[model samples]
Target: MRRHRYAKIVATVGPATNTPEMLKALFLAGVDTFRLNFSHGVQADHAKVHASIRALEKEVGRPIGILQDLQGPKIRVGTVRDGRLDLTSGERVRFVLEGSEGGKDAIPLHHPEIFAAVVPGQDLLIDDGRVRVRVVGVEAAVIEAEVITAGVISNRKGVNLPGTLLDLSPLTEKDRADLAFGLELGVDWVALSFVQKPSDVIEARGLIGDKAGIMTKVEKPQALDRIEDIIRLSDAVMVARGDLGVEIPHEDVPARQKELIRACRLAVKPVIVATQMLDSMVNAPAPTRAEASDVATAIYDGADAVMLSAESATGRYPVEAVSMMDRIIRSVEGHKLYHSIIAALEPGEEETPPHAVATATATLAEAIHATAIVAYTESGTTAARVARKRPAVPILALTPNVDTSRRLSLLWGAHSVRTDDVDSYEEMTAKACHHAQEEGFAKPNDIVVTAAGIPFHTTGNTNNIRLIQI
Candidate 1:
């Protein structure tokens, strides 16, 4: 089905919406992509959900994107003497690297990487920073830290060390296993978490190859330090605000979100603004006013997609959440301020033939009041380039490869259609007009812009642009 909005919606699937009926309903409501979070479910369960999404895609006759989110690593505190222990402020706590039961002063934390990298004066935030401590002395096998924000520190509570770059791989054994399963299952995108540098993207690329798009989750301050390099290496980027907010100051998240969105758009890569867009909808039927404004702000900043995490994965009102986000995006995109705001941030194109032609195609289509811009792409690059321009009209992408079409579903303003390949210019024109009308994007007497390459089915050779009368 053709959506009325420009920015896409990515909804995570879990206990609440894993069934075929709910999946279809969510898709109908406005979910362009479905994320199978590997953190919570087994492979068997995810396989069933993946099969269900493909079935729905067939029934609806539209390309649906599937993103596999790998749970990177679980760094937490080891067990203490009891299940929990209370540490008072201004008291000393000794964290040992040995695996042994200890009291409040001698807690066992066996992560060698933490001890190898952590230094004095660095803060250790526990249980989402409710309990904090600062390192006073670093030893070979023990770390002496004084409590800063004293509270009950329990077993397996997550640890966050902000501003300290740990010398560790982003992927763990579990993530490697999950990646293998997801790639075999034919997922469209793979989101890498716990990324700390551009090398993380390169490492994932070595494993993922071209099987699926590698989307780096920008959640750490170190990732932001080298974000431009990471963005260039990654096929896509995700503004993961949950862990990011935990790592950085809360006030800085809005500006970081905007910066990442702008960088992704400039690079012509699809960016998804994820985590807690409509979190209150996890139990409620509707979202709060603040949540609605949060979603609208992302669309106004020109994000390719805004995602729903718990709101759809385990929420009581999954369909309502998707519908509300869809309405919010449409409302924002329909406003004059949104158009002005987004258009004003359009980055300068590179002085390359392909970039110039792509920018010109978008400009020409909008200037002529075309109904849509039909992009004939082989690698989906041409369509993605035009999408980066953020034109006013819709982008109808025609591709022979189903994978390309499915991946394009996550791009902004793109309605991807799988069609047969065209060889000649005349055949290209006929197919473009036919599919433009067939897809309900155009009708008789409507004008459409066709972008194709001279070598026919080549990639990144977008040197030709034509105006067609439908």
Candidate 2:
């Protein structure tokens, strides 16, 4: 089915959307990719879901991307005494590095990295900021903090430090096992959470090693300091706004989201705007106007894709959520201001033959009113370069490798097709025209601009463009 929009939809799979029939409905509803959140399910459970997705892909004969999202290391307080404690504002509390149960007088925090990184005056948000405290003193084994916000603190509540950077690996021991399992399952993408620095991506790269594309999760406030380096190292980036909103001020998230999207676009990498996109749809068949506007805002900001987390994974209306997101993207893309807004944010191109040719391909397609922009790529970079432009024309990306096609599923405007590689210009044009027409993107006498390297099968050589009349 052809979606009349550019931005793609990534749906998460869980109990609600795990059946093969439901998966097929989601795909037909316009889900280009599926995310397996390792935080919830065990390996055995995820294996079955992955198998079902593959079966659906075969049934539909369309490439579908699978993302293995690793649940990275988490920082939390140890067990509380009597299960929970009620606090009052201005009350002083003591935290010690221990593993035992805690009382009002003494709370246990097992992570030593937090002690090493935190200093006086930094705030610690517990349970997603329901309980807040300011660090008043730090010692070798204990920390004294003053309660700023009073709420019930439960056992094993998560800890968040907005200003301090902790010295810890983003990957937990469980993530290592999960990454190995997912890689063995032939997943196309791996999303690394709890990332705070570029070295975190480097560590993941050491393990991933070209097995799958790495999508860095920008969830920490400290990561914004060096987002450029992180974006450069990552194959893609996700605006994980859940923890991000907790770690930073709530009002700053919109600007931060725009900055991240623009940075990713400039780097010619796919960026997914994620977290609570359609929260109300998790229970209701329809979304609130504000939620609908939120999805449209991301599309207007030129996000490569928008993700549905719990809305699809565990929602009462999983298929409806995906369909609504599709409708929102189409509505926004058809809006009068979307084109100019994206054009205004068009990134400066690299001064090279490959990049210049990609830019010219988009321009020529617009000038000639081409039905589509066909990109013949081996590594998906050529298609990425063309997509960075956010042109008015749609993209038909043809690759010899199914992996490439699957990876392109997350790319904006990319209608991926896996076929035999074309070795010459004549073959490139014929194949491009055939796929464009067959895929319903063009008809005879319609213009389609095709871009490829002179020597076929050579990667990163986007140095040629041809305007073919279908």
Candidate 3:
């Protein structure tokens, strides 16, 4: 079931391909992972998909990764009385805080937080910037605005006040409940969207408690500001280019995507490049040449996985999209520059503690001709560090938390196993050997490299390293 490849494909499940037979076809079509987007599907919908995926895993006799993407705090306007309204350019519009009957001149906006954040001369974009408005004045019960662009505003249209530091956390009560449901469903990975800082990852980790892997979606400017810390804290990362492109300048996204991919590769965490990989396939049976180039660039940039959004979820050609992405990845990987780019982008020895150890361990593993490298990790930090090296041998990461195991599936060359945390170095080595044998990763007298923290109790305290013959 395991393929000796560096890149993987993640396909989204939606109305177009929700049946067990369809899921099985997707799995057989070369999808390495499945993404269940909480933004669109309900619990019942997801349960069906999960059941189908599980059944397919058994029937195919291979481990298929499942990622449940939680819908983060999505800021939108409340219910519109008429369901739709037209705003003309330069028209003065009053957005009332109360839910009373208001005419076209005055519309009701329920969120007071947005009202408080609204200042004089702040641009407000609606429905991904189809319509624009400028705040003229702010009162206790309303926000007075003048329409800068004319468009039809519908019910619950998404509002984006970019660069206006709203006094709000990214995660809402809905996201918390969704996270709980995803964990209960035994999902392999849980992707938290609209993450702003490292604390978001910490809070999500505390709530999930290792039940599923936590992958933060780097979509905001604030997230990019704290990229290194966020990567260090999160189990894995997803380059969620959809909102990210909208949040930041479009030109910056390409460079930012490369930067994030390189950072995750160096950190050894699996990084997924997502959104619109084959957007045209939603209607067209094939992707545009530019879309094909976009996917190839992700693989050349050393991404662990390339994702399909609407292409697989609601597209008319769902299976074709997945199959195309798989073909593109394989084709790009065959080029000489692919390995060269990966090797050239490899992180050198740094002054940091974890980085230093990871670099040295990777070098040692290659030098000793080790069959496998076993990393006993509590916070999953050491495993990521090893992955950054991109060593030729497989990295078997033994963790006490099941969530950590699932999350590591995205990382390059990492195979995760759930086990009890070791109190001593000897136990760590013995268990590493035991799991290696059980997984058929190693045999008697096979050389294996082991790394773990010396204290063993503290999280992210990785330091110790050793070479052993299993």
Candidate 4:
């Protein structure tokens, strides 16, 4: 089923929504993409989920994208003998390099990069900042710290150093293995987590090549420092606010989210605002009023998609959450305020051919009152370029590549459908008009602006634009 809404929904798959029937319901409800979180499940479990998604895609006749999220450099404390311990404020603690018992006084933290990179006065956040510590002394094999925020410390709790940039590889051995498995499963997108710099994207692009789209998770504070370069290197970006909120001040998240979304729009890259959009719905039947506003705000900011984490992964009301998010996005898009906000945003530079043509397409559609803007794309670049202009009319992207169509589902205002390849301008124009009408985007005698490369099946060769009447 096609959704009338411009923004898309990304749902995480877990035990709650892993069945084919449940996946189909989610897709029908408005989930354009499925995220396979590698942090929780094994390769075998994820393989099953991937299989169910493919089955549902065929059954539903929709291009559903599968995003494989790699858990990158997750630093955690070693196992504790007592299972958990409480630390009081100002209590001295030692983190050692060797694997040993984790007690109230001393714990094992074997990540060499953390030990080497962190210095005195750096703050350490453990268990998502439930407990905090300040490094007072540092040694090659150990670090001495005093607890700042006292709380229960559990075994293998995560560690976050907000004050220092660890000299660590973005990918771990586990991530490498997971990436290979996801590639084998034919995932459409791969989201690299904890990206620190542009080099991280370059490294992942080397591994992914053209097999899948590489999406960088902008989580770390350091990552924001080099966001421009990283955005240039990666195929897409996820405004992962969960870890980011932990790493930086909570009040700064809103502005940062807006900046990230705006930057992605100007760059003509698909961006998703993720983490806890409907978190309360994980347990409750309905979301908080605040959650509804949050989703709407993302749409107003021009984010291509808003994601759900535990709310869909293992939530009690996965389908309901998707439905609610869909309604919120549609409601916001129907408002004059949303349109005004989108119109006010600064677009990309129009000097380039793609940007100029895309801007012209949007202008022509509005000027001529065209029914829709149809783009024939092999790599989805043409569709993205048009989407970046934030046109008032709906966009129909026809592609022969299933992967391209699926990935386009996450782009704002682009309704992607799989179709046969068209070799000539005449064939492309005819197909565009036929699909626009068949897809209910237009009717007979309606006008549409079609854009594509003349040499069909060639990537990044969008050089033709035509106004066709069906």
State the C-alpha lDDT per candidate. Answer: 0.92, 0.93, 0.82, 0.90
Report the error of model 4 at residue 207, Å.
1.2
Q: What TM-score, computed on C-alpha atoms, does each candidate reach?
A: 0.98, 0.99, 0.84, 0.98
Q: Write the per-residue lDDT of candidate 4 for residues 1-470, one digit (tens) a residue.
A: 66898889999998899888888889888899999999998899999989998988888787889999999999999987688878899899999888678676569898998888988999999998899999999999989999999998889899998857888888999999999999989999999999998888888888889999999999999999989999999899999999999999999999999999989988889999999999999999999999999999999999999999999999999999999999999999999788789988765565888778878888899889998999988999999998898888999999999889989988999999999998777777789878898888999899999878777778776677799989
Tens-place lDDT per residue, model 3, 1-470, is 45445677889999988999889888777787899999997898898899888888778655678998988888777666578888899888888888744666667777778888779998778887788899999998888889998998888888877666666666788888887787888998889988888888888888887677778999888788889999998778999998888777789999999999888876667899998889999999989999999999998887888898888888898889988887887788777777667778886655688778877787798888998889888767888788777776778888887556656656666777778988886788789889889877899999899878888867776687899888
Could you tell me which 10 consecutive residues in candidate 2 have the lowest summed lDDT?
98-107
What are the clashing pairs of model 4?
none
Q: Weakest 10 consecutive residues, lDDT, candidate 4?
A: 346-355
TM-score of 1: 0.98
Give candidate 4 regions above 4 Å deviation: none
Compared with the true structure, what per-residue lDDT tens digits does model 1 show for residues 1-470?
Answer: 78988899999999999999999999999999999999898999999999999999999999999999999876788887878999899999989898767887778887899999989999988888888899999988999999998899888888889998998788899999999999999999999998999888898899999999999999999999999999999989999998898889999999999999999998889999988899999999989999999999999889999999999999999999999999999999999788779899887787888878988999999999999999999989999999999999999999999999999999999999999999898999899889898889999999999888888978989899999998
lDDT per residue for candidate 2 within 1-470, as digits (tens), equals 66788999999999999888899999999999999999998999999989999998898888999999999988888888889989999999989997578786689999899889889999999999999999999998899999999998888899889988889898899999999999999999999997999999999999999889999999999899999999999999999999999999999999999999999999999999999999999999999999999999999999999999999999999999999999999989998988999999887888888888999999999988899999999999999999988989999999999999999999999999998998788888889889998999999899999988878879999998988988
After TM-score superposition, what is the CA distance of residue 183 in candidate 1 from its true location, in Å?
0.5
RMSD of 4: 1.2
lDDT of 3 at 340: 64
